[model samples]
Target: MSETNSAMTLGKRSLMGLVLGLAAGGALYFVPECWLRDDFLINTVFKIVGNGYLNLLKMTIAPFVFASLVMGISSATDVRQVGRIGIKILAIYFVTTTIATTFGILGGLILKPGAGLSLGTFELSGQYEAVESSFADVMLGFIPTNIVASFAEGDMIHIVIFAVFVGVAMSLLGTQAEAVKRFNEDFANVMLKIVNMVISTTPFGVFALMATTVANLGFGIIYTLAKYCVCEIFLFFLFGFCVCGGIFTLLARENFFRFLTQFIRKVAMIPFSTSSSNATIPYSIQFCRSIGVSNKVASFTIPLGATVNMDGTAIMQGMTAVFVAQLYGIDMTWVQILTIVIAATMGSIGSPGMPGVVMATLVVVLSSVGFPLEVIGLIVSIDKFPDMFKTVLNVMGDSVCTTIVAKSEGEFDREVFYGRKAAQ
Candidate 1:
């Protein structure tokens, strides 16, 4: 009971912070430069609070990811159960992500958001350097040469690889590894506590972030990228509601609107405001559980989805590739468009769920198709605005996949899904 109350309090306070912060930030935008300096206010004040909160969340992620994956796998009933669930999750991810990428590309081609714009129209900031990485590079990068260095650097791909090995070994050992399993489970609990404490401060952090974002760029930049933003938003809704909702309806055999209402009530705000799906994992797991997903499935799928199932990021990358291509007057062949679809889908896997990181990953997609990297600078400043919405979509994708996998594995409770009974 106390835990439920605490969660409710946090949600209300966080929402208040989001609204107040946006209002405060917008008001600050109107302040004269002489009265309130950007250096003193934005770069110093907002940067410290916002980034500090994010850094706190990042700190929990490494340990949490390691411990949760270890616990999720080690505590499973059987290896075949793990493998079966894994197959289902991956299948859902691939199909939905491919469809999402296609939607994004189609939106870009249909909208032609960049057709009227010239490269000289927008001030492109930062050095746009594309780091070309092939599939072999990604595969090899998954195995860590130095596990210690991987943890220290917060490399999730390496951490996940190591965790899976440890988990599978423990699962095989069974009772012999019981002590180690308990230790990992306890450690995961500790990390969840830390995450909850940090989540409580979300209101303050989001306020600072929104305030700084508005103060720095205001609404002018959004206007410049309005068409591109609109296209992305449209894709998010079309994919989130129509595609994802359709899947949930067909697979879960429940009403999508009902699930959506409960999802919004339980888990939507955190991802929407924080723009970090990793930060929202604990809440997502709870939300899944509330809808009757079992502990084993929820633990494994939500965290794994945090790293791999980035439908939202995939959409943005696909659209951006086409948008940037149009901006530079570079006509991409059908081969290049196909490359964008494949690259975006693969690149989104294991991509860090951090604010504005998509701008960095888009480099790989753009490079694959030989799009102008400099065009990325045109959208970097405004990435944060779209990032919030993208994150909501990202986690919603996670929950949908989690629900479907849970049902397939017989780990779901239909009564809870329909709100006829509370999850126990």
Candidate 2:
């Protein structure tokens, strides 16, 4: 009861934060040019608050993920059991991803979102230094040459690789690695606490972020890019109903609508509102636990889902790649379609769980097919709103994947899933 109340309080605070931020942004947007157009007072204050919060968030991701991942892996399963669970997880990921991208490809062709926008090309302001990473490079990149350097640079995939080895070593070392595992687990808990503290200031951060957005580009950009929302929504639900409802719920023999409404929709609102997967992890774990996932399984799968599973973002990539192509008047070829599937899949894996992360990942996909960087410029301006939905889908996908894995491992409780025990 106390825990539930705490969650309610937290949710209320976050909702208040969103409302306050939106109000401030609206006020800033409506200000007269002569009075406050270029005035740095409001802009300057919010920028510092907002950007500082963002930087603080950026600082936490690599370390938090590193600590939690190592702890989760070390504690979750025995070394021999890792292969069975790992293969199943990976297989589910690939299969569902195929469904996602297929939905994207067919949706892009049929729906033709962003088809007739007479928008000018805007240059994407990021350096995509053309470096061809072959399959060999990708395979080799997993093994960090210098573990210290990987940590310093915050290279997550590399960190994930390194953490796995450490975890395996810990498992082998048994008592020798006990202290280290405890330290990591403690460190992870501390990081999560810090994240909640940081998130408490999200109102101000969101205020400045939205304010900066509207001040520079104006809401007209949102209007212009509205079609992208249509595309994303279409794909989000299409995937949601079919893949989530069909593949996960139905196959599991759980009531489809009940699973969507009862389990997912409740917690999914967090990521949708906050647009941060890491922030949503606590709620996600709670929901999964309430549904009867074992603590170890929930702990491991939730963090791993944040790190690797990105069904939501992948769907966006498929559609966005096509949208960019349409903006440039380029008809996508079959070869390019295949390339997009590959790039989108890989990009989803590499994309971090942060604000504006999908944008960073869109770069990888765009560059893979030789899509003009300038197309990114036009699309980036209106990325904020779309990103919220993208995150909802992303986190929802993670929850689904985690639940499925728990079921396979027999870590899930059917009684809890259907709330039979709770009824007692």
Candidate 3:
């Protein structure tokens, strides 16, 4: 087959997989009692296929992250440039994350969706133990003690730091590092290929995940959490369209909606299905680069953004805290709300990029402010929906941050930023 034809074939297969997966998931929801009663079916086929896909995606994450970071760092001309870019990226990430948390708090305060609601006795699982490490210890730990352990434990932050060091070291060596640089680049490309191969099955993964969630939880949960879900979605649109859009417009002096048009479909899909900023990193990179952001900006910012900056998660944490407070008839002072925002922002940064991590981290943040865990437990059962929306916002924030940084660095194509499509 011609290369073009082969690519098309793969695209078709991916789409077909998504449809089949969704269909299968939907079918499971209405399956006969006997089929549903089979514990093996639930534990084996349904759980395995859905959860297994997530595990496989996660399995590739460490290598992909490190390889991409190595490739990004090696491509940098100097440490000074890397430092400048890194600082800017982190600043944007921190500021926007803070804002996201604030936005959630504001939304929750205004909406008060959980007012007068009572979530009676519930048990919270997965208690997170605080790592006794100090700030210095946390910083030091960013350098992997053992590379293999970082991957085994899914330590994204450590892997990212290690990749950056390798990249910078390779750049310092110049031509002497040619072979290593070439090797890292080749390795990253190969990993990306592997990622593509795995992501082709995303439809199936989404289907299984959705079906299992629907069957186990049922639509009744949505009705119960309808107000909460509505409030959360409102925050998603408000942040994505208003807050983030405003930032991009002020910086680029362009229409934010127009800028979003080109990549909305691509960015929106990953979060809805995968509900992970980390899983969506590959697509975010592709989308940013396509829209004329330089490799330097996209590579450094997007990956780091995925790790440290999750606006959606931040927003969810803040709002959920307020919701819990309201549910328990606990009136939070301004001081308490401010503390929740700070805690949520910090917790999100420290949170790992995995399913259930954000929810757990939010619980930690809320608990710090004396919010009830029982309410958090109720939120957890219906987290998948908000998770999807939050992932979308997180990815969108990354893209916006990249665009602004690229523009400031003179690495952005104004035409493309305002253009109808990303550069080919």
Computed on alpha carbons, the lDDT of every model, listed in order, comes to 0.73, 0.65, 0.67
Instruction: Give the per-residue lDDT of model 3 (tens digit) for 108-158.
Output: 999997765454433332222232445565345445689787667655455
Model 2 residue-pair collision total = 0
**Candidate with the larger TM-score of 1 and 2:** 1
TM-score of predicted structure 3: 0.59
Q: Which candidate's lDDT is highest?
A: 1
How well is each residue in 1-424 modelled by candidate 2, as lDDT tens digits? 3433443445455445545655565666777764355557455676686667666665666666566556655653343555666666656765676667767877877777767653455443222223455666545645679988877865545566676677667767778888987888788778766665665565556556655555554565345467777777878877887888777765455666766776555687788767677777888888778777777777767766775677877888888888777765666666567667866765565345766545545655665566654344334334556667777777777767777887878877889777788511
Better of 1 and 2 by lDDT: 1
lDDT of 1 at 399: 95
Where model 2 places Cα greater than 4 Å from the true spot, the runs are 1-81, 118-224
Instruction: For candidate 1, write residues 1-424 as lDDT tens digits.
Output: 3554564455566557656666777888888885355777777887797777766656666676567557755653234557889778867877888888888888888888777755533322222223355667544644689999878865545566687788779988888998998888888778666767766676677677767655655654345477787778888988999999999999988788988998888899988877788789999999999988998999988887887788998889888888887766666655556667866776676455655446545655765554555444345434556777899999999999999989888999988887789898
TM-scores, in order shown?
A: 0.61, 0.60, 0.59
Candidate 1 or 3, higher TM-score? 1
Clashing pairs in 3: none
Alpha-carbon runs more than 4 Å astray in model 3 = 1-81, 119-224, 420-424
Find the 10 residues in a row with the least total lDDT in model 3.
122-131
RMSD of each: 8.6, 7.6, 9.3
**Range of the 10 consecutive residues with the lowest summed lDDT in candidate 2:** 122-131
Count of steric clashes across candidates, in order? 0, 0, 0
